[model samples]
Every structure is written in C-alpha cells, then in structure tokens.
Target: MILLAAHGSPDRRAQALARGLRKGLERVLGVEVLLGFIEHQSPTLLESTLELGRRGGGVVRKRLL
Candidate 1:
C-alpha cells in the first residue's frame, strides 16, 4: 500500500488535483494509492494510515512530492 501524503488546501481544486493524481499514479504504478492530507482537509494522514491497516495493507510506504 502506498500512502500519499499531501499538503492540503481549503481550495476544492487542491482536493480534486490530489484525487486525480492518485488515480493517475494507480494507473501507472499498478498499485493501490491512498490519498491523505497533512492539513486543511479530510482523511488526515494518520486517519488514512489507520484505514490502511484496517484494509489489511502491510508495510506502508509513504512519499511526498
């Protein structure tokens, strides 16, 4: 499981862009991509990490860009 940690914004466009990027990454990487925000958004990084654990995903690898 890949946990994508992003610096979130209140702007809707930022949210849309994050989702779109996650989708594109999933397509290109052929892996499950989970989106999480560091701040100013829903599904915070910690929340996403916990959710990932619930999903039975192991050895989370995080990358921020």
Candidate 2:
C-alpha cells in the first residue's frame, strides 16, 4: 500500500489533480493506494497511517508534495 500525503486545497482543480495522481499511482503500483491530506482535507496522515498499519501484509510508502 502507498500513502500519498499532499497539501490539500479547496480549489476543485487542485483536488482533481490529486485525485488523478492517486489513480495513476494505484494503476502503476498494482496495490492499494490511500490518499491523505496534511491540511484542508479529511483522512490525515496519522489516521491513514494507522489504518494502513491495521490492514497488514503490505508495504506502506509515502509521497509528499
């Protein structure tokens, strides 16, 4: 699994970009990919990391931007 940590934005364009990147990552990695926000969005790093840890049996990687 991969955790993508990004600075969240209220703008629709920014959210769309992030969503696209997340999709691309999921397609490329062939594993579960989780999206998270450092700010301005839900499912923050701490929450997502904990959830990923609970899922088990997968490597957790992060991409920050």
Give the candidate number with the greatest lDDT: 1
Evaluated against the true structure, the overall lDDT of model 1 is 0.82
TM-score between model 1 and native = 0.80
Q: Which residue pairs collide, candidate 2?
A: none
Candidate 1 pairs with clashing backbones: none
Residues 1-65, candidate 1, lDDT per residue (tens digit)? 68788888888987888889889988998988888888888799899989888998754555443
Tens-digit lDDT string for candidate 2 (1-65): 88787787877788788879989988997977888777777788678778878888355555554
Error of 2 at 57 (Å): 6.6
RMSD of 1: 2.0
The residue ranges of model 1 lying beyond 4 angstroms of the native Cα positions read: 58-65
